[model samples]
Each structure stands twice: as structure tokens, then as C-alpha cells.
Target: MKELHIVCKVRKKRYRYISQISNKITPNLLKRDFKKDDPNIAWVTDVSEFRFNRKRLYLSVIQDLYNG
Candidate 1:
């Protein structure tokens, strides 16, 4: 669905925008670099789907770079 694509882009781009400007939003914003040395600095994760018993199972993660 279109909404799914829009949301997926939003989720991925949220971290990108936040990394550059702290508590600020801009129309012409540049993408943020994914390089940090803090535990919560790099919170990267992914999601996937698998069929189980004819039903869909989704998986997601919110990882910490320090612990991982």
C-alpha cells in the first residue's frame, strides 16, 4: 500500500534527519551520517515478514551500537 511505503520512508528518514540538527526541522535538509560512538547513537534495525501457519509474522529491532 501507499501508506506502508510512506511510513517506511518516514521511519528510516527520522533517524537521518535527527542526526544532523538537534530539535530542528528544515525543508531543504541534508541526510545525516550514521556514525556515532554512543550506545544510543546508532539505533539501527530492520524488519521482515515470514509466513507461519498461513499467517504473516513480522519482526523488528531497535538496536544499540554500544551493546551490540
Candidate 2:
């Protein structure tokens, strides 16, 4: 690409507003115990973000520890 004089453009990160920024840490309640005797007694969820083709994609999931 250097021979072709191609250049890639990257966006600069913008400053976040006060409401969007967080300084507190959340406590974990599950303590890494994934096994449960019954459904709905304990639930787990996760969220992930990916960047592809210059676009952002988010995946969110929730599952019961008993059956999952």
C-alpha cells in the first residue's frame, strides 16, 4: 500500500460526558460459582462488543445457571 500511496484514517476518541464516565467498581455477587440447584435462583448475563467492517456490533445474553 505504501507504493500505492494509500492511507488509513482512524477516528480520534472523543471526551465522554460526566454522565457517561464511571469511576466506581461493581462488586461480584456470584463469586464464580456456576452451578445451581434450581432455575431462576441464580442467573448470569454477559455483554460483548465487536468491531467489524468499520461497524460496531453488540451481543448480550442471559442464562440460568441450573440448566445452562
Candidate 3:
């Protein structure tokens, strides 16, 4: 192996400024209303996972709020 000489350069420090705004509150539209009057109006979907024999299984379901 042969010896080598290396040169290093220094960089100036940089700073960043961030501005923040106040948060506003929003109202809820559903308000725990799960019932629907007409069909195909509203539908809810959920995903569930289970473990079986060292393997993972996922089940996805979508039900109509009016009928179900």
C-alpha cells in the first residue's frame, strides 16, 4: 500500500425559519348517525386481520348502512 494525502473543505452553517398559524376547530357532520334512509346512499368498510398457523390473514368487508 502507498501513502496518500487528502484535502478537506469547510462549509458555512445555514439556518431555516418556519412560520406557524393558529388552528381552527371543525364540526362533525355524522354525529354518530349510522342509519340511512335510502339504499346505496351510505356504505362503511372495514378491514380485519387474524393469525392462523403462523400465517397472517386479512379480511375486508363492506356493508350498507341502510340494510345492514
Candidate 4:
């Protein structure tokens, strides 16, 4: 997270980075097994992740266009 402090004396705002307590959502596993007889579904997603520091983290998302 980041914070922007506004001050009249400075031309630009000050920014502070805040660490997070929990990790973000990331993709860990994937599987696809669908037949032509399957019903129509548009979207699917997977998510898991890891946090490096109070201010840093990695996140990922996996998506499928068709039902599979």
C-alpha cells in the first residue's frame, strides 16, 4: 500500500509505503476436461500468492475463456 500526503509547502505530495499482513491471490493449479455436450459457460478463474514484505507482494490470476 502507498500513502500520498499533501502539503502546501511542497510542490509534490509525499508517498509512504505500507506493508500488508496477508498475501494476495495467485494461481496454483489448473485443469481442463470438457466435452462438446457440456453446457455453455463463459469464464472461470483460479487464484493464490505470497507476500515478500510489508510493502511488496506477488499476485496472479488464471482465466479460461470457455467452460473446460
Candidate 5:
């Protein structure tokens, strides 16, 4: 029977780097209020884009929350 000894080298510790810059918060105007008592009083609009055959297409829609 024979005895063996092993040796290992230590390496320097590394830390994660993060940016110190802060992001600005924007205020919301609607504040999640989507209810309306009368028609045409409140409306929501949305826009979307799609790409097909190396071309760009855009679609815009307006929705009325009152019975629509």
C-alpha cells in the first residue's frame, strides 16, 4: 500500500459588475381607469406592425369601450 498527497492552487475572486446609472420613472395618466358612463367618452387605440415578404405593414385600430 502507498500514500499519495495532492496540492491545489488558489485563484483570485471575481465579482459581478453592475452599472450605477438609475432609470427615470414616467407617470401614468390613465391610472388603469377604463370605465366610462357614456358612449364616445372614453376610447382606446393601439397600433401594430408586421413584416411579410421583406416588407413592413402597419395596422392601427381604435376601440370604443362603450358597447364595443
Candidate 6:
């Protein structure tokens, strides 16, 4: 790999900045119901990280639960 000029990229570990734990709890508004009848209602979002071509990339996706 060194003779062909190919380098490997290593992934680093991420750490949290906060040290204290909170006791607050958030209510579940969806109630485990993911199915939706309306097109614009019940939108969900997710963030993902990917390593490709020796570069790190972040992807954010937002989709409607009705058709998705």
C-alpha cells in the first residue's frame, strides 16, 4: 500500500462534552405509532456519519412517515 501511494484513514472516537446527568424526562408524543396517513405529517429526522474516499461526511435525512 505504501508503494502504490495508498493511505488508510482511521476513525476517531467521539466523547460527550457534558459531565452531569439530567433527571428530566421527555414525553413520548408519537406513542410508538409510526404510521401516518397525511403526507406532511409525522416527519422523522436522522443524522449519520460516513467515511468515504479518505474523507468524513455527515448525512442528515428527513422523511415523512406516511409514504416512507
By TM-score rank, best first, the candidates go: 6, 2, 3, 5, 1, 4
Summed backbone clashes in each candidate are 0, 0, 0, 2, 0, 0
Is candidate 2 or 3 superior in lDDT?
Answer: 2
Clashing pairs in 4: 19-54, 26-48
Q: Please give the range of 10 consecutive residues that has the lowest summed lDDT in model 2.
A: 13-22
Task: Encode model 4's per-residue lDDT on 1-68: one tens digit a residue.
Answer: 13666555655756776676457777543344433343444345555556566555556665445545
Q: Which of the two, 4 or 5, has more TM-score? A: 5
RMSD in Å for all candidates: 13.8, 3.6, 15.4, 13.0, 14.0, 5.0
Question: How far off is residue 20 in model 5, in Å?
Answer: 26
Q: After superposition, how far is residue 50 of candidate 1 from its true place, in Å?
A: 0.7
Candidate 6 lDDT, 1-68, residue by residue in tens: 99999999997989877859787899988898999988887889999989999899999999899999
Tens digit of lDDT per residue, candidate 2, span 1-68? Answer: 99999999998988767887689888987888889987898988899989899999999999999999
Misplaced by over 4 Å in model 2 are 15-27, 49-58
Reference-based lDDT, residue 27, model 5: 85
Task: Show pairs that collide, candidate 3.
Answer: none
Ten residues in sequence with the least summed lDDT for candidate 5: 1-10
Q: Against the true structure, whose lDDT is highest? A: 6
**Residue runs of model 1 more than 4 Å from their true location after superposition:** 1-35
Q: What lDDT score belongs to each candidate, Candidate 1 first? A: 0.66, 0.90, 0.82, 0.52, 0.79, 0.91
Provide TM-scores for the models: 0.43, 0.58, 0.52, 0.26, 0.51, 0.59
Ranking by lDDT: 6, 2, 3, 5, 1, 4
1 against 6, candidate with superior lDDT:
6
Candidate 4: lDDT over CA atoms? 0.52
lDDT of 3 by residue, 2-47 (tens): 3555556697867665466447677776578899899888788899
Better of 1 and 3 by lDDT: 3
List candidate 6 segments past 4 Å from native.
1-14, 19-23, 52-55
